[model samples]
Target chain A: MTPRRSERSGPTMHDVARSAGVSQATVSLVLNDVEGSRVSAETRARVLAAVAQLGYRVNSAAKSLREGHSRLLGFIGDNVASTPFAGEIIEGAQDRAWADGHLMLIVNTGGDRDLEERGIDSLLSRQVDGIVYAAMYHRRLKVPAALREVPTVVLNAETEDGSLPAVVPDEYAGGRAATRHLIDHGHERIAFININTLESGLPAVVERERGFVDAIEDAGLKLDRTLVKRGDGDAETAYRHAARLLDRKRRPTAIFCANDRTAWGAYQAAADLGLRIPDDVSVIGFDNQTLIAAHLRPGLTTMALPFAEMGRRGVARLLAGGSGAGVDAVECPLVERGSVGDR
Target chain B: MTPRRSERSGPTMHDVARSAGVSQATVSLVLNDVEGSRVSAETRARVLAAVAQLGYRVNSAAKSLREGHSRLLGFIGDNVASTPFAGEIIEGAQDRAWADGHLMLIVNTGGDRDLEERGIDSLLSRQVDGIVYAAMYHRRLKVPAALREVPTVVLNAETEDGSLPAVVPDEYAGGRAATRHLIDHGHERIAFININTLESGLPAVVERERGFVDAIEDAGLKLDRTLVKRGDGDAETAYRHAARLLDRKRRPTAIFCANDRTAWGAYQAAADLGLRIPDDVSVIGFDNQTLIAAHLRPGLTTMALPFAEMGRRGVARLLAGGSGAGVDAVECPLVERGSVGDR
Candidate 1:
């Protein structure tokens, strides 16, 4: 259901430039975030405000006319094997695009940048309206030279210098929510289990740990070193790490898992040790993978990362015309169910 | 990513038709399941055997050339909003497609046939190589007019006549496995929760129930009508249904849910009723949705539907000149976790 954009009329890029009292090229460069060019924050803000006030909309067809090919948005990501969130993001984007009468051409790059480049080239050969560099998580993004002219949005990935537009989940906030849930339930000894992965000199696991620690510290609770367990990102490793922590002399009453998959491993480990969840040891995980979390015996209480929302909004923004805007962050929501026990 | 056809020699559609002692049109009709045409059981088998022997391949590019777009495939139907199975199907198809030189231009029909037709039109206007009518479950499929000439493979869905290639989970085996697990654990008073939906008329679910009944009848166990629960294809309804069944005077020692989502709801119901899982009653669910089942407190033991494998196999079949081959079925494997318990 590709949207027919001619059905709607609104302010175009030229209109936004005119209203913002800036040149058309500057408006595009400033709004789209073309590399090697700098625009004052004040001017960029003015242009954005003008866009908002005038209800400025992007005519992907017009852009495609100028460039050739319909502005086919390219989403580069892995299949279900590597990232569970890819499907949701693609769905959200498709839904949004359908409403706007725009078509998106997605390519699964299989974790290879060269393949990603070739995919982008295919999209380019078709004269895509824009390109969306969406990954499975908030990992470091690598921008290719061929995509410079296209309006681009990086989904679930971070950009250097905040020059490229990116949309990702707020992992730190999600961790805080999980920790707060456990603390409010009268649990004093809490543990954090996370995978070890580095992204842009910072690990997603560490950031989540920081948020959990911050919550505990804010509550005046002691954070013990014995309570923190780092998994190697595999179910076996996570299960082993959790077993070691739970079988300790003074184990934490509640455990916060890095993600749903890791939480699954933790569940197996607990079951193997005959630890009843929420009674012997309560468990909470991040990223509410609907299928696994819901079907778990005592359904997993986890945070729902806005993967679909991020993909939808990112594509919406790109299609709506804000290629030059800096990264935008979406909040993750908590889905409470049966995993956590009442202390 | 779309895989380009191998420039090497391969068996053509003509080769399969010639070896099968059938007309080329007959082979296409049999494989595509054109209505108002009858393909004998023996003839269908012979064509498939010929295809297998010759190693014949369908040139998606050539097919698209005959029709007009790239040798791109289109998949309709999205269960991501409710079930996690659709993701794996797309993932499997996408991954296999990259190597086979065909790109799947997936359109999320969101479970609406009209929207599906629109998606079909969008694909056909561009001249697609073929179309794959993928359903979330194995139910009667209504062929759309737009799919008249496009080679199609129905996934988790079946037609009135078993003339088309279709891939579905082996439900009878899945049910047998679940029941066998419980029976081995010494459970006698077992209840089955079936999903009540238009598609519940699905042969797969029927086979599962048949298997369950067979196991119980074989054991000569008295089945209670009050214990059988039916969920309205949702977690909330499943919760309510499970609550009613579990609250009975003589609650079953074990329960089997139709799908993972239903199990999630049932888990919530059991928790709300203050019953400890496997202590009061053990529960098992179908469809091993890793994200949901694995993360549950007790971990859900379930049957894994081969969505990825089906998608991969479907694409492989399409490329292998099995495009018009009749009625192909794939097997679903079982995955055991902690949900099921000894009676």
Candidate 2:
């Protein structure tokens, strides 16, 4: 094949300037909103008309917008493939970015720090307007050093310094709401089944526990240390924990699980003890993981993490000139189902 | 703010040409791999050094490779958030694309037609090298008109007309493999539970069923029509279907479920009937949905859908200049667990 440039090449900025009888600098200023430009309205109109007539588009190899924006956002995640909520978060970001006529370049780090740094460098190389660093779970993390080179936001996780705007689920509220729901049902002896705090290093566990403590204290109920059991937040672990608790002489009439999996274990424990859900022991859970919560015999009443809303707000803030690196929390709505009942 | 180019602007082709003492066209030919260029090896070496010295990295908005390529691949999906394998597919594509020095622009359409069209348009406007049209499930679909404009490969789904390369799970092999696993466990009479065939319009149903039939016939076991049942592929439906089969005097020793959820339903049915899992009836399932399969009391043995492998192969095919519109099937490995027992 002959090495030749196509005759009908895409129109460049220079072509627009030439057709408009103006300098390329004038065209760039009027079109790209360069602050304090001296170009007149008539000349701007002529340049715009010429650009329209020529169907000019900034080529990927030589694009130089005066505002220095690429209209591209980088969504960097850790091990997104195996993470259940990764899709929801990406869906949220992609929908919003596309709505604003922008594109997203997604990079899943597979939880490697080197890979994450490389992802950030790649995003920078592409001149993305901003970057969103996200985690599969809600936890504290060390922000990647490369994030310092660009406007960055963290999602579903937080940085130690709180120097970047973050959008995280209100896990504390979710826990408090779960406990309160059981309390409202006239259950004075409500047990709390939680994931082990120190072992997990997950904010969800620490905040949820705090919320449980606060709610019980605020409700004028003395917190029962013996009734609070910690496990690995799995069905088998929860089953063992609940079994031991229910075997006690003064078993709680209601149970609030840190997560739906724990509630599932509680359900099994109750069944093994010849107890009926809600009828004999009311139950509530957090993070209304639909697969487990909805599939349980008596659909679990749990808290719905505001995953999509967090992504939406993150982008909205970035577009609204966000800075100052403050932490933000989104509401976790109570998803009432059939589990909790009156004592 | 003087409406002038930045002093530290990236060096352009002109700079490289000037440094190499050659025309800009010659530099472009040598660097971009334009075919049939008669440039000397020494001149090409000089241009390469100049390019390295200038640090001329291509920007996202104006990236241009030889043959008008942009080094950007579009990964367009429908309703990826709710899908179980979204992360696996994306991780495969992203890791593969990045390994080849290409970046993927992902667009999730939430199953909306207009949004899908807009996504295609957006990708085309950015001059993406090619597109990977992905679906959340394995089914036949109407190829978007915009797909006609670009080189495309469907992932996890097929177009009505085989006009594009597709990488899909071998559901037939998976089903046969599941049934064969039960047979291998010394079960002569095995029941097949599945999703509705015609109602679902999913190729998975038909293909998987075909494989089940083939395996049974190959085993010289008469295909028992009474042993085959179609349900909604939910626990409730599977429970109902399972109850009828268990009620029979000549019940099958094993059951092959369409999915892990169906296997869960079978477990419930066995429990309700006071039957021990491996002692009374062994069960095997399809689609190793970790949450359900691994969590089930006796982990449900199932076939793993090759989601990541399919995505990897799809990108590999596109990179290999795929356009034959051939459908490639990825192997679904049988994951052995405790669900199946020796009869």
Candidate 3:
């Protein structure tokens, strides 16, 4: 537990104080810039000059002890820091934290309960000002008991007990927006390619489906039950469903894919069947993952999840002392590209 | 500068010591399990029982002060923590650090020089045991002056001065491997879609191209300059180049794409030309980005960048006192899928 010197051996505060001809206490007060201190401006200047000359940097550990806060926020997520879409959540939170003069201490647990517990302990031991507990996808989870002792906000997820503040994408609104966009394009017969809830009971699946039905009914269009198909939210499954739907005797003029990956499969189905996009069939997608949506032959028009916004909001909530014990649904904006056209 | 109480008050160390009928110092030694401490087993048991009953957590700041080292590794990267491929580097470094009883303190700079300087200052001030300076891609960079004060290892990058230890992908070896895979498939007439160094003078571009030429010549095939085309390392540009090659009178039976995104474009071109993958024309790609590679109709056969491995190696070097200097070229293993077939 002994203090080890850095390899390069930078000048210490004591050396700076000695050079400035001031007591170490005066140097500490001048360097920390403590408010309402009785030190004269000349003394402060002398200490500052000595610090610059000696290249003396404040020891953050000692500073943290004196301030009682580390000016650091802990961000713990389950498989969010490394994944494609979820990584944006970390970026959003980090940017927001940095803007507030706080740096994020990130720990990605990849959904290991043991690691998650250890990560929480590590963050708590480090005395992070607050914690942002996040999930890769929108879902309900039970947070660890240790988090109750710290100011905590959940991102892209909600506490099962609903005792903590949370921010998640407005899946219902996103679904409504996607359907309404297709309707505005003059498409009456719109088929829905939904994520299979049986395989993954995600809240997004049920909420988005509800929004789709509500939009169709609101538009005075007859909702055909047979027009809706459920897939495993993957390309191969969506391809088979799209191929069948497009080949039907009474084919829908448009298809609303649950996600970008699903839309990718639909694109291939239309391509293989010699059906031109927007001209022969209009398609819309959700989760505008730029990697796929932007690069498709004709760019895909899809709904963009507010991952970054959710992250920012989560950190903001923590900074505000983790107030408001309820789930806050952020709006998902529609990103229009080359995929949609007049039906 | 005063210590602020957490929202939910937790039992402090003093409270545990009081309940255990022991001095605070005895509790500290028992809890920290300091090596060769003179605490009897009975006293340790009593202290642990009190800790469990009171739910007391150690103050990490105080522990860090006692131990000289924070037991934390600082990871400062230029847009690596939130990107697709680069995020893996963080994961690799984090996993390795955790295995050695260290947690990574990650800071993503997004290539802002000011932020990079501030991030390094923050890490140094916090007294991180070491640092991992990383770049989003393989390239050479000048590290900050502050980095000299600590043990630093560059990940997926190298220092301009070559004074710090670094780990980057073996771009030349990857390129050679990609070409050899195609040649092994009995491809005589092969073409290469290379990254345009005019737009991005990345190390991968030059090294990979060299490896491609070397592999072709080593296989006793006639090197054709006309077969090599350059693009912006994107799907659209690669699409145009691939379409032209496919339409030529003496088209190549196989093509090697510099990256997966470029290969995705080539896939579309071949499909549009009614050429089935691996059946009619073969294709290979570099940087096996699973988001594209695994989801493509037929999985892509490509070279996988050793991003995660580089991260692990970088952290390992830092843990080993950052002893080695010069660059360590990690091998990019070939991931064989359904893309390549016999010509």
Candidate 4:
């Protein structure tokens, strides 16, 4: 017969017990740091010394069984590993879970449906008390069939059905604030560069556009239909669109980019046309992607995605005995930097 | 008495037992996917059907107890989440662990020594089979006191005492390759932009410089001491250094930047002096940070850090019954893009 893993490995609790002249149970109590055990101080110290000498590691599975809870929280994400700047969600969730005396079991599915389903099963079989489903970009997602079997919350994205509890950024508020910030800087003619949301049906795009329009109309400013445009939400595409707008006979004094990368393209366009930033044309962006935003000659003024807060709140709600069916929105705060200038 | 979590949350295996008119143990056998069980097909189907009706979730701790392994690996890191482009390490480790039927319990300590200690304790209490300690930047670190108890491997960094198994990138080899690539393109008079490592004592800086010097000397090229300049490893500082080099009576035809960001600074300096990239001066960088390298107009030619490979190998070494006391260096492959040009 094949020997079990424990038998094949190095020293065990039994070895420590033999060395310390105590029962294996006593060795376990001391190694596990169990509370209120009746073992004498000297005996506990002897067992600990034996453990240190023998390098005895308590088998986690057995310990979990004895304790009745694994104290592990499952964190499942699609494409999070490949997505840049979105890692803070995992960090925040892990930090909060650790503070609450739980470990985060992270599973990056890489957007594979089969792998995602299998990941959930594995976490469940490992007995994670709850699961946090996350996405790199905010959008509606199909619910995993196995997710309902445990306490689950969605992060950065939500189910189209709205059946599961979710924590996400308030995109509309961020858009309105960005537009308002631009207006407050004495910019009347403002152009809005939007994302090509027809392909993905992302609510952020549509809602942010609505906020832009509301801000414009609320200020009694005429909505210039010709000023609004859509791009692939990439720098290259944003550059082309920005150049066209700048080359036109009439140009806006300020522009609001859907995200920071787009704003970078707009910056490139301004450079190409020999137009100085803010002096030639002011710009505001969203998502505050620091690689682009912070490093730009004049830093970008934009809204920060509440990824950390969402992760923190998601874990908090899970520990609060939530039923896994609701949506809580986190506010995106504005970061003032060199990109924005007063007219 | 207060009801157990399973009793309060939803259906229990006992509910399936009663509905199917079979023993709860039989239900567990079928649902836990236990191997070598001899339950009849009819009874197994009935138990599964009843489980679906009652939504019975299998308790993982009990299953782990029966199997005698938690099948969980702990991943502890400092500043990994906040760092740009380091998520690949976690991805590779998580993917490998999952394929081996193991879960990775991740904890980001953000360089807090006390928090690091507590995080390790938490993972151990959850019963992780082994631990993988990682860092954002490759450097020597003080090992956590709790780590010696279990099978542990260091990723992207090594312990100061050299007592732990470690997997890290071959920065020296990478520097050689980057410099060689420049020579292969028929470039002479290559200048190496070194990082300011006076205070940090970072091995990457010292080793990379050695590789650059060795490659230049092996090519029978006289090394010019004036061509070597140190920067703060930022784009701004790099730009200043690059400008000074270009302003000299004789400028090197090509430049090797300490990193992608430094290369970006070089590119900007080239533009400021009305010099076109490759046409006037070819540039190569280290660390193919896609945000800066790939997104640049010419696309940077640089070396890729073997983060994913290191993460994968670290876990594999632990499972291979390693004693956790050696360093395994992974290769840093060169990524050739548009920046390199034939002289």
Where does candidate 2 stray beyond 4 Å? A1-67, B1-67
Candidate 2 CAPRI assessment class:
acceptable
Candidate 4 A-chain TM-score: 0.88
TM-score, predicted candidate 1 vs. hidden true structure:
0.64
Docking quality of model 4: it rates as acceptable
Candidate number of the best lDDT = 3
Worst 10 residues of 4 chain A by lDDT: A1-10
Chain A TM-score of candidate 3 vs. true chain A: 0.94
| Per-prediction CA RMSD (Å) | 15.3, 5.5, 2.1, 4.1
**Model 2 lDDT per residue over B54-142, tens place:** 86644445435345666678899897788767889999988888877677899999888988888887786666767888998898888
Local accuracy of candidate 1 as per-residue lDDT tens digits, B288-327: 7776677666788888888889888777766554455466
lDDT comparing candidate 2 with the true structure: 0.82
lDDT (Cα atoms) of all candidates against the true structure: 0.72, 0.82, 0.87, 0.83
lDDT of 1 by residue, A1-343 (tens): 1112132334678888888999999888876577877888899899889988985644333333333344345666645444566667878887776666555566777677777776766665444557777777677656777666566788887776566788888878888889999998889999888777434344367678878989999999998877787776556778888898888888788889988778878887887788888678888988887666775667889988898799788877877664475767678788988889867
Candidate 3 residues lying further than 4 Å off, grouped into runs, are A1-9, A198-200, B1-3, B6-9, B198-200
Query: What is the DockQ score, from 0 to 1, of model 2?
Result: 0.33
Find the 10 residues in a row with the least total lDDT in model 2 chain B. B1-10
Query: Model 3 — TM-score against the truth?
Result: 0.96
- Model 1, residue A327: C-alpha shift (Å): 2.5
Ranking by lDDT: 3, 4, 2, 1
Model 3: per-residue Cα lDDT over B257-339, one tens digit each: 99999999999999989899989889999998887999997999999998889889988888877866988999999999999
